[model samples]
Target: MTAARPGSREPGDQEQPGGGAGAAGAPRVPAPRGGRAPGPAAPGPGTVPAVRRGTAPRQRTGRERTGGRPGAAPGPEGDGRLTHQELMSLLGVWALDACSVQEAACVEAHLNDCARCADEALRLRDAVTLLGPPRSLDLDPQLRHGVLESALARRPAVRPVPGWAAPYDAEAARLDALLHDINADEWDIPVRVRWFAGEERAGRSLTVAQVLDHLVAMDGLLARAVGLPDPLGADAPADPLERTETRWRLVTAAGGDSGPARLVAARAWEEWREQSRELVRTAARRGGRTGEEMLPVSVCDPGIFPGLGAAAGPRIPLSDAYLNRAFACWTHAGDIADAVDYPYEAPLGAHLRLLVDLTARRLPGSIAGRRRAGLATTRARLTTAGAPGRTVHLEIEGAGGGDYWIPLDSPTAAVTRVAARDAVAQVALADVEFCRLAAGRQSPAEAAVAGQGDQAAISDVLSALTALSRL
Candidate 1:
């Protein structure tokens, strides 16, 4: 840990010297115990930087300071100031060059204003630098070939992400990058997947390979719906769930011999990626499918989990279908990361904003059906949820985000601008958290909703959003 610079000690830690009147008749107090000499008087301006005296550096909040938790209100300084904890938490990541642009900026800004933080960041950076590169070791020629094969096996056919789908695409690409160096043995590491059913956490567990197999199965449906070739052979079942389970069995069984199994998984994954690339390219060629080109695209029955698109679900534009596919790819990538114990970062800003926008548009109607079936006074329940007010302010922060006023009374809420004061509830969520909540992968109880104003109205909106999708 970095030591504080001279004069940066807390007031309590500074020696308060006391001394009897000296021969010159100057009054002074004696020095405090601990054999410390009297501290020097504050330096004149320009001689030394001013020490910011006051409260003990704010106690660390939670495990580490973040740029504020997803929904916690920002300090009066807004998001510019990094708390001590925030700076500390960011130090290691920044040193490793693994931090996002926003996070890096926060640390840099905090370092400028805080000598303690700056010193600490320097110490950490130096330690990292001293570690240097790993000692070189001769590798077996066969081992090198296997590693290269594994890395290439994970590479999907690359393509430029369309403007609206950039975040989703970038996130998927990140997951692909994560698999590059994983050991063969780590492929089977399993992770528990959970979702809130009312208040209980429930969902299946999956291994890295199994999760990729599932993506291969699910995205195959998206590919077909968007008029791309089926990644799996024609023998697969028509029902997506049945097909998924059936293909999962085949893919997993084929890999019974680990070497052969990896090849099987790799082939399926590559085909899916290639088809995904084609799907996007096709959509782009059609001028991105605006207006009339944006038509209802029902691919399969709604009963099947991650059926990809619903037969009876509302008709969405063609661009949304691609975005939805991207969401699926990126989300499962998160699952793979959890299994392998790698840190996963989702794309932020515009890409994530698009998904948030999609969820906001669907919120009202998703609740309307349940409202009619469950409540005797449907109008009252709807009003309590603030649907009558017609709009809720969603403050989705970090990456692919903006202040959105989502309409609560209709199934399709066009992107309308509404003032902060006019919203029924000002709900705040991080980009990934909101996407997970909207996708039905996370329930409200499982997700924290940071908000101001009508608590009931916020709860109402969240409850309606709890299970918007089955996958």
Candidate 2:
């Protein structure tokens, strides 16, 4: 559960994977359209779906006129600061260009000062825009332009932060986009975890809200472990699983079978998500290294850190903790997708590569812990097949494709890219399937794997992957 910081190595450490930035495949948003993103456009035909997968919507639109009353009073009873409820109400009105001149000015002014509100407004606008314009009425182009211009005027250009953890940020963004427009009723649909962990017959289940609550609970553990604030706050339980269960129960209770309560739960999930994103951002600022760093946490649950008592959990690398969070997020995203009946697949790009690399880097330690003799003497070259450009490379095609080499017992065991031309064992599968296997969501028997040379070595590697997760 501990890890070396990005670009750092401990004794007997190998080169780090993802040491080099891969293809810049993630879409390039205009650089703030002269330091501000253009105002969001209405969703084109077939744009607005109730809920979509984790793909981020394009925020680009053609240039438009900027027109809105400036320095106007918000409303009859308004002070400068708009309450949360008021701001929420105005978001849709503003997006649809239905706001009065004073109201539009007030919203724009508020957005200029509040980044969070600005983000929400943009998202809301995108949702409305996705619904597309009504075919019944030929709306004036100037009206739409005015709304977009006002919205754009207040938007400051945002630059992506560069760090080793950027991949994690990208993954988090996709999950957030997926959760944005879900209907309140969908939150109560029970999710079956049968496909994962072979517990189908156990009848284990969680509703959409419960799944999110579980995520917040689990994320809080890693956050506290690495000195980040616990999203669940000070009054939560001391045990990790107990705290998660307790929180889930409270979330369900707070969701008092009322429509508003479910909406509140959804908002709460968004808050938890922001906290999780903040952790990634903070870590990136620290050069993306957080292993074995000591930090005080109110609850030190032994369940979160196996083999470590409460007192011993403080001194832990946050990177390891973050990886743990990433794994949980990736695995549970699949669960959420299943709950909603959406086709789910993890990207084979940076985030998955990091997960694979982390597992590969820890293979030695895993073997040593589970089978002591196996670690002391086992020396094998592990490579991946099925990727183009490299003869012995791991390939994950589709959205986030990349070629990687798994260094089993090499001096540079941590390196993500492969330098070795030949490996004693090469196993190839799609990245999503590989992730499932590594996460223990799929047993080796269930995984479709092609292996060549050193069948015994292949078994060892697969065994290590199957047992990699402590959760």
Candidate 3:
């Protein structure tokens, strides 16, 4: 007879003289180490005593054990064997090498016998191949620098962000990154948005997801102007205040206005990202054209703040509107940062300068608007942009900043550069602080660091800056 191979069992190795045989002539086999027994088939639990012969089992937690037993199959209760559903659920962990040794043995044995499980196991193992290997959390420090350098290289005629739209693009991208990184639970965290409305400190409370809902409604206006669909449907109110309310109501009805509003946030987030991308693409199509149109989109209504005329708000250029969108994005991003206790930097120098310039240019209108509502000292001394007029030497200090002699009376007046000494008063401010003031995040009382000249003009200009802020 041919010699039995190494580790092979002899005929009747696991068979007792009495019974316990599997199939015709083949023994119910698992010849255990150094055993000599002729005993009855086990009838109950522990009757077939647990024999652990391998290395000591690792410290076990829930549903964990070491090696599988030899010859000891499950009793009537199928004790120690996992359910089909349980085994299926373990496929991922098993693929990842996370399953305990006993569980691995169980999974392997079951996969061989059950075609369905075997198919799933094959697929899972194939997927695990794509996982490669475990990696360390520590990343190369220059990875971000390399990636950004790659993405920022200007591909002319392709995704070219116009100079005016860069701030909006950057801020939108920053906010999108923040949203992508946050967990579902963070969506429910409360955020309070403050702005100067009706000539007073006005504020409202909303969850983070609700905040995104608000953003979608507001940004949808720019989307509409650019011929993109609004997140809040076509019939949505043109007025921002009403639009915001309408958005919140819809979110509430959808069962996403409250605790852990992950669905709402996710929907709004998708819309925001898509809309932002579309906007950038549309701007790219403009090819440096200002697309200057009378966008009556009231970011801050002349009626909202008291003294402004019954006349509609500024007929801001579309380029200016893009800048406004960027400003709002940056401001709200800061709100999100506060909610999550994250630190975020302000816009870059060029972008910040443009933002500040826009806000400064609009200040004259805000002051005039506030005056009509009796908020500022009405100055009838109209200054012409062509000829010399009452100009504040608005010294914006820091990057993206330049000296601006903004006319106090009218938005139409030409801003002729005047000698520094010829200025009525010089209001010097850190560039970012001025932006915060315009965003209504800071009060006029604390917004200015040093003001020398007409305190009244300074106060009026400062207060009017906040008037630029809206819901």
Q: Which candidate is the best by TM-score?
A: 3
Against the unseen true structure, what C-alpha lDDT does each candidate score?
Answer: 0.53, 0.51, 0.64
Candidate 3 residue lDDT tens string, 230-312? 88898888788888889888877977655447776777788678888888888887756665655654533433233333343
**Candidate number with greatest lDDT:** 3
- TM-score of each model, in listed order: 0.56, 0.51, 0.64
Between prediction 1 and prediction 2, the one with superior TM-score is: 1
Per-residue C-alpha lDDT of model 1 across residues 394-449, encoded as one tens digit per residue: 77777655565645443332333332346766889877778787656777766777
**Which ranges of candidate 1 are over 4 A from the true structure?**
1-161, 196-200, 232-240, 250-264, 290-292, 295-297, 300-313, 373-390, 409-422, 439-443, 446-448
Q: After superposition, how far is residue 469 of candidate 3 from its true place, in Å?
A: 1.6
Once all C-alphas are superposed, what RMSD does model 2 give against the true structure?
18.6
The ten-residue window of minimal lDDT in model 2 covers: 27-36
Q: Return the number of clashes found in candidate 3.
A: 6
